[model samples]
Target: MTAARRAGGPILVGLPAWVYLPAALGGLFVITPLLAILLRIDWANFVPLITSESSRAALIL
Candidate 1:
């Protein structure tokens, strides 16, 4: 067995602070667009909008 495995400890203890900045930016990049879409939703008419014929066709496609 490897020395690390023999020690019975985690292989990766922690990450550097610099690593977190890019990780956070990547997460925000992906989530921001979805959040913007959700924010712009007309909640009161949401069901009708999704149930519309055009929407159903698009979903089927």
Candidate 2:
């Protein structure tokens, strides 16, 4: 085992600068759809709609 492992200290690894752009794009790609869905929600009736019997049934299914 290495000295760091033997001492139970955390090991850090450096990543290449080119790796960040693709990582950021992938994160934005996942988050954009969720943000769009949230924007489309009818906030005025959100509570009642979510608490209705049909909504409960659909969630249960």
Candidate 3:
């Protein structure tokens, strides 16, 4: 028992496939909106658009 304690543990725990399934689904749920906004952005003008006065005011509000 002392040797096992020094070695870290006697019992090992593992995540189930069901746990991974929910985690994957939750990740997709959270990422979808971010991906949508990324897709809608104009990459070439992104910096200018984000820094414009109107955009800044909207964000501040």
Candidate 4:
């Protein structure tokens, strides 16, 4: 047996490739839309946009 596998020694295990793929894709899935919204933000209209009637009504609720 390998030294790592011997009694009281540290044992190591390998993870499957498939495990990481979903996690990576999920991270991208969540971040992509938020990034898109941030990218589309109009700095010039930032204040007026958020202060509009609809925006105020939405915030009040």
Candidate 5:
């Protein structure tokens, strides 16, 4: 939300902040694999998971 605003995108216009949920979830999905790789976990055992920040943000609502 903050970065989009800085990049000149609209901030919560016709749609409420709810519109960002899917995008945020997609972000989590993308980041999960990257973090697991950085941690050097065995590829075969890796299970992509949402980051703690994403979980907290979702719960706060």
Candidate 6:
């Protein structure tokens, strides 16, 4: 096919490229909470909630 025909297929060229920044920031907004939970976690409580072998299982994952 010709260039014009390909352009009609997806039409990604000369599009609103600024959407990438907001899309990436939106993804970060979703993941930031999970990161905070991992960071401020109480490691000491794992001994009761997770035994030695269970803790090893968690690590293996």
Q: Model-by-model lDDT, in order?
A: 0.86, 0.88, 0.84, 0.88, 0.68, 0.75
Q: Candidate 5: worst 10 consecutive residues by lDDT? A: 42-51
Candidate 1 stretches greater than 4 Å from native: 1-12
Per-residue accuracy of model 1 over 1-61 as CA lDDT, tens digit each: 2223326676644566688899999999999999999999999999999999999999999
- Candidate 3 has what TM-score? 0.68
Question: In candidate 6, what residue range of length 10 has the lowest lDDT sum?
Answer: 1-10
Model 4 segments more than 4 A misplaced:
1-17
- Candidate 3: Cα lDDT at 3: 25
lDDT of each residue in 1-61, candidate 3, tens digit only: 1122336557655665578788999999999999999999899999999999999999999
Compute the lDDT for candidate 1: 0.86
Question: Which stretches of model 6 miss by more than 4 angstroms?
Answer: 1-15, 50-61
RMSD of 4: 4.2
lDDT of 5 by residue, 1-61 (tens): 3333436666543556887899899999999999988888555544433445666688788
In model 1, what lDDT does residue 51 have? Answer: 100
Candidates 3 and 6 compared: the better one by lDDT is 3
Q: Which residue pairs clash in candidate 3?
A: none
Candidate 3 yields a Cα-based lDDT of 0.84
Candidates 1 and 4 compared: the better one by TM-score is 1
Quote model 5's TM-score: 0.39
* Alpha-carbon TM-score of each model against the true structure: 0.74, 0.77, 0.68, 0.61, 0.39, 0.47
Candidate 2 lDDT for residue 53: 98
Please give the RMSD to the true structure for each candidate, in Å.
4.4, 4.9, 5.0, 4.2, 15.9, 7.3
